[model samples]
Target: MALDLEGYLIDVERARGLEDIQTLILHLRDQYGVDHIVYHWVSSDGEQYGCGTYSPEWAQRYVDKDYLRVDPVVIGCFQRFHPVDWRKLDWSSKAARAFQAEARDYGVGRQGFSIPVRGPNGQFALLTVSHDCDDEAWDAFTLAHQRELILIAHYFNLKALELEHARAPEPIKSLSPREVDTLTFLAMGYSRGQVADMLSISEHTLRAYIESARFKLNAANTTHAITRAITEGLIVVGGTSRAADGGWPGRRTPS
Candidate 1:
């Protein structure tokens, strides 16, 4: 079935609170014919929040069992800057295998796609969709909706950040010209040395500017910083970078 993506986005923007977001996720799960759709976030100060279509029993079981310690999806996705398929994550360890089995028994699907999201002020989140389906069907579904899902992931994070702002607003910091230039070049497929040379700065100076920008953006890494900068319209990429090597150069694709 074709999802009314435009309508869903409108509904998301109109969402007033976490309850609205949860309702939207439930709607998405049903509309996409998926077992579950989840949005989970952790703030820099260690606060956690989530909205999803998963059963309460299963959600409780996960916490009770401390399943995250052995959940390969969570661990793998945390280290990645792109979307991922569950099959690509390692589940070879006995503990991981046991956790997988437990999750399956709790109605978690065999197939899943997850997008990692990073927001300002050190927020980390994951937007995931899971379903019970054969490999071929799952592959087709993901291929057909990959771009939509990516857009939704970013939108979901944006909405969450908006909610945070309402709770306690913070002033945004503008990046220095050098920092902006460095990130723009990095996003455009230029090496660090290349960006430094183009900006007529030493590599050491460039690194300093980049690190400062990363701090201002509250990004976990250089790639994360570049992505946040681009998403926030702080910089524009003229070319693609090594960090975005696969299909779309500067855009991250599912692996």
Candidate 2:
């Protein structure tokens, strides 16, 4: 089914608290005809918060078993900056395999897809949809709704952050002009040396600018700084870099 992103955004903006997000998850789960829809994120400070449509029993079991340590989805998604299919994640370890079987026993799903989200202040989150379906059906569903799901993931994260700071949003300091240029060229697919040359600066000067921008954006690193810049409208690359890669060039896999 086609998602109404405009309508969804309106509803998300109307959300008063986490409870409202829980309701939204349920609605989206049903609308997508998926068994579960989850949004989980960890703050830079290691604080975790989330909303999802999983059964209470499974949720409790997951916590009691400390499955977070063994869950490949969480482990893999933490290292990635793009949407991923469950099959693509490594589930070969004995502990991981056991966790997978238990999850299925609890009706977690036979198939899943997750979108990794990175936000300001180095926050990391995931939006996942899981269902009990064969490979072909799952592939078809993902192809049909992937873009909408990505939009939904970001919108959901925005609302979650808003509610997390309901009193007053932590103000985002503006990037300096040098910082802006550094990020723009990087996002435009320029190598650091190439960007330094284009900006008429040495790599050392460019590195300094990026580190400053990273601090301002509260990003973890250079790639994160570029992506955060794009998402926050701090800089506009206009796909000059994305076109070359056939995708966003700033995607990261954390070490």
Candidate 3:
């Protein structure tokens, strides 16, 4: 099952545009026998884009009503680093309850599981699967499907990132040696002072290195810089044998 899902993910990765993504979402919905599947992303400049199995009417209504303001999925997912179940979100608000009803009316399932993905430069995206199954069935399905969902979420995010890169005003800059060293230390759970002492630099210097790395990586902050560096293979986790000596890890050869 995992191998087959991997093949599906490879196909999804090859999708080139919004139309291709919409097709893939529909295909996955059918393959998994789910009621709906969606991929929605908000870029750094507040531009929204996505493709999914939601009805056109619902999509239009969502936009017309500006449901983005009260949608629990958007709110809850933004605050989370992991998958969220729809039931766990605060749908108790009158507006949220009305939105949920409208969503159901438009064929969005009553039950949902969403994975929130955060990318560099404040890019936020979500991959969600929704269905009308009972709680026990939904729970089991999500457990069975969690790994595949995560892979798909990452694949979707990568494609979006690629598109964003293609349309970017400036090319992303590569991290420098000192900048890489700073982020690597932070990624490995090092304190700024600890990293500075180890590198024979002052804490202020260390902060400058980190901030430079963050800017080069187009990251929103230090943590985001570390994550982007690791994801882009600019740094490797546990690849540092000299971590004990307070020395930075050897840099990866450029691919």
Which lDDT values do the candidates have, in the order given? 0.84, 0.85, 0.84
Q: lDDT per residue, candidate 1, 82-148, as tens digits? A: 9899999999999999888988887889999999887875678889999999999999989988899
Alpha-carbon deviation at 251 in model 1, angstroms: 46
For residue 99, give model 3's deviation from the true position in Å: 0.7
Write down the TM-score for model 2: 0.64
Measure candidate 2: CA RMSD.
Answer: 15.1
lDDT of model number 1:
0.84
lDDT of 3 by residue, 165-226 (tens): 77764745777778777777788898988999989999998888988888888889888989
**Model 2 CA deviation exceeding 4 Å by range:** 167-255
Candidate 2 residue lDDT tens string, 1-255: 656779987898898988998999999988888999999877665557688987788888887787777889988988888889999999999999999998899888999999999898687899999999999999999998899889889988998888878756677788776787789889889899999999899999988999899999999989998888787666767744323332334444111
Ranking by TM-score: 3, 2, 1
Clashing pairs in 3: none
Model 1: residues with Cα > 4 Å off, grouped in runs: 44-46, 169-255
Give the residue spans of candidate 3 off by over 4 A: 1-3, 169-255
Model 1: per-residue Cα lDDT at residue 19: 94
> What is the total number of backbone clashes in candidate 1?
3
Global Cα lDDT for candidate 3: 0.84
Better of 1 and 2 by lDDT: 2
